[model samples]
Target: MNLRANERLSERIMPRPHRRFIFSTLLLCTWLFIAGCAVDQKAEVDLYRRVLDGRVAATQPYVEGESLTLVRAMTLANQHNEQLGLRGEDYLQSLIAKNRAVANFLPTVSFQPSFTIEQRARDGAPSGSTGSNTTASGGSYQDSGKISYRTEAPIVGSMNLFRGGGDIANLQSADANIERQRLLLLDAQSTILLNVAQVYLQVLRSERAVEVLRNSVSLQEARLKDVKDQFANQLATKLAVAQTQAQVNGTRATLLQAQSDVRNGRHTLALLVGVDTINGKLSEQSVTDAVSDPKHTLTDYEQMALDRREDFAAARAAVVSARAQVDAAFAQYYPSVSLNVAGFLYREFYADASKWNAVLLANVPIFSAGVIEADVRSAWSRLRQAMLNESFVRRQVLNDVRTAFENLDAADRKTAEFEQQVQAAKEALDQARAAFANQLAINLDVLVAQDQVLNSELQLTGVRFDRAVFLLDLTRAIGVLPEVTMQAATRPATLPGLP
Candidate 1:
């Protein structure tokens, strides 16, 4: 009885040991799961931190006292503009294509390793496995089964010896594509520069207009004050005071409009220069002095544009690229040749060996449903279109040069005439003011003279602004703008009141 009791106690103890092992295993698994979660959470936090840092960097403010000029604006636009970035990506792709085309002439190498298992059946006499003749001698026979395994590792290489010049033509086409992208980038730069110039000039013009109108308003205010004093002394009528106040109000309204224009221009310039704000003052005198007569003749400008224009160069590159495409298409008419080499190691249930092999292959083009011929025709059509486009661009360049030249000449003559008008109007206003003070002229005549003087000054400002714009346009048409240094100037703390 004691032996049986001890045996039952040992069994119970063994079962308790198994339970403890199970509990420990579950606890360990739970700890591992928690640890994995903690690791993943840590990684997520790091990623979020990096993203937040990038956001902070992108939102950083521009530096103070950063002067914006034509060249600086162009550089900034090129660096930040999405369109330029896209073109740069395209250029990179073209370079990759060129490299790929060159690689076609180099050999390609690869490796393949594989394992195979097979089962086969054989006819034999029981365990002895005698031949069929033994079975015919009245011996018992049965079918036997066997399993086998095989492994093979191979290194293979191939190279194209000839592709009827298609590879060469493709390489040439890639080169042309690269050239086209470069010229396109240059064209984009020129266009951005011109746009920046336009906005810059507009800002200067609006600011100057504001200044002129402020002066006019001040003069009108003074005149109104004088009229009010005369009326108090019974020397001038209340009607004169009312008219002078009306003139002041009108000038103030115009000044407000000009100030609005200045703000809008600055906003546009900020966007172009990739800055949050534009802070520096534009040099009006420097800009006016930069607008001079073109030193070259119209014919010379036309020739220069033809030679230096990016669009013209891009058109030529397109023509060459199209011709290469034509060649690539024609290459399909001929046969291709290639060479292959392979080294292999093979193993089976009964045998293991290694071997090397070389092969030369030739592929001759057979009858296809006019696919190759169709491609040739399409390529030729594109080539023709490219040539025609080049011609059209040439004609367009000529027209632009001549038109810009004519407009610039007209602007020069108009500017000279307006200068003379401004001088005469100032003299006439002086005489009118003197006569009014002496009581030889009426208040109406003096007011008309003041209006004429203001009008003449405003008209002169417009003419000068137009002349500066025309000069820029003419230089752009000639495919070369005179470089102007960005002069450093202090920003004014305050502008004059608009109302």
Candidate 2:
């Protein structure tokens, strides 16, 4: 009976300890699950921030169709162009150069005046005439005291009669340089505008692509479920499910890459317009409107490029400047004449000493060891080089026109071809699904048809975007731009739509 009582006590103790152990185990698992969920949330936030960093925010809110325009982009580019506007230093330099040129035509005037008091010895040499001499007395001194005052004032003037034409050539060169700088500023503005447009288009395209891929992933997931169901029923092979899964994963990877590109494109556009945005999604753009207005044909582009391209004009200007330099270099070998004159006013202790003095002098270039000859040769060579470069650039511009025209044509054709493909694939997909419903087609065939449709849709979207990009490139290459109307640059295209 004592043994039986001990056994009962052991059983009671065992049940309490076992229950406590099970409760502790359950608590630990709950804590681990909560900790894992927190880590996943933190990771998602980081990804969001990274994506936000790449995108440009709209400066102001507007609908996609009306927010930004090409004319507006040009305006913003010009307004924000760092080099176009005149600065204090630029004005100062221009004035200095102008003054130097004007000085060649005007007389320089300056004043020289002075006053003094002096004592002269009786012997007629102005001096203190101090000397110690022995006298009849032990210590006697003799000193001379005579005071006089005198002053003289002079005004000087000078003008260059000739510097063989160096001064004139220099003035002409300065004017040419100023004009060149102006053209350069315009060219820079054009370049910036083009960059803004391209980046903006890229962002828009990327965003749209992301959206399409998201939809594609959903479709892929749904198809995956159907394939798994078929496999479970032994009507579809395992290999079919695996193929669908692979396509889904591949598409997901593509989606990720598209998102990354969209982010980077947005960042570039943001910096161009000087926006300071972070941690916010970029707004979508309607690139269709911006790119829809292209009107120039290949021939038109060639003609316009030859006439309107800023680089071509700048090249011609450079050639002219180089020729001017040659002339200036040759002119250095000739003589130059300058005149100098001076006048003095009265300023003296004595009235007779106060009078005006004037003088005139001429200067000329004498000689330098073959320096002028070398300069002329160098200038002539540069002129030749400039001319050659101008020709080369013209040819390059022509080539670009041809290439852009070809690309534009190809893009147009591809858009049409892909659209047709998408239509055909859609019909095929429908037929496959109907056949499967009637038991005449397998699930695998339907899945294949769906993939083909998705691929065709993706290709068509890509082709559309390519056509738009080509349009932009052609516009830029032809040096044609619509007037910019906005106060800021635009964001890039959003992602493309997927199947």
Best by TM-score: 1
Q: After superposition, how far is residue 241 of candidate 1 from its true place, in Å?
A: 3.5
Deviation from native of the Cα of residue 396 in model 2, angstroms = 2.0
Q: RMSD, each candidate, Å?
A: 12.9, 28.8
Give model 2's TM-score versus the native structure.
0.70
For candidate 2, the clash count comes to: 37
Against the reference, the lDDT scores of all candidates come to 0.70, 0.62
Question: Which segments of candidate 2 are over 4 A away from where they belong?
Answer: 1-74, 81-103, 109-126, 129-155, 232-235, 278-297, 344-359, 438-444, 482-499
Which runs in model 1 stand beyond 4 Å of their true positions?
1-62, 115-150, 285-294, 345-354, 482-499
lDDT (10s digit) by residue, model 1, range 1-499 = 9998986654333334434544565576688679866635455334323322221122234465665554455445544555655565566567668889999999998665444333322433343332221233332222222332234456789999999999999999989987887676656655665677788888888888898999999888989989999999999988898888888899999999999999999889888767778777665543336344536777677777887777888999999999999999999999999999988743222132337679999999998799999999999999999999999988987888788888878888988998898899889889989999899997877888888888888888887777777776766676654232121111211111112
Model 2, span 1-499: residue lDDT tens: 9998887654433334444544565576688669866735455333322322222222343233344554444344444434334322242354356567667767777654443334343544235543322223222222223433333445667777778887778777666655554444455555676677677767767877888889989988998898889889997788888988888898899899999998888667656654443224444443444334345556767887787666777778778777777878988877777776666543322243324444444455566787878898999899899899889988987987788789889988888899999999989999998998788987678778877887787777777767766666665566653222121234332211111
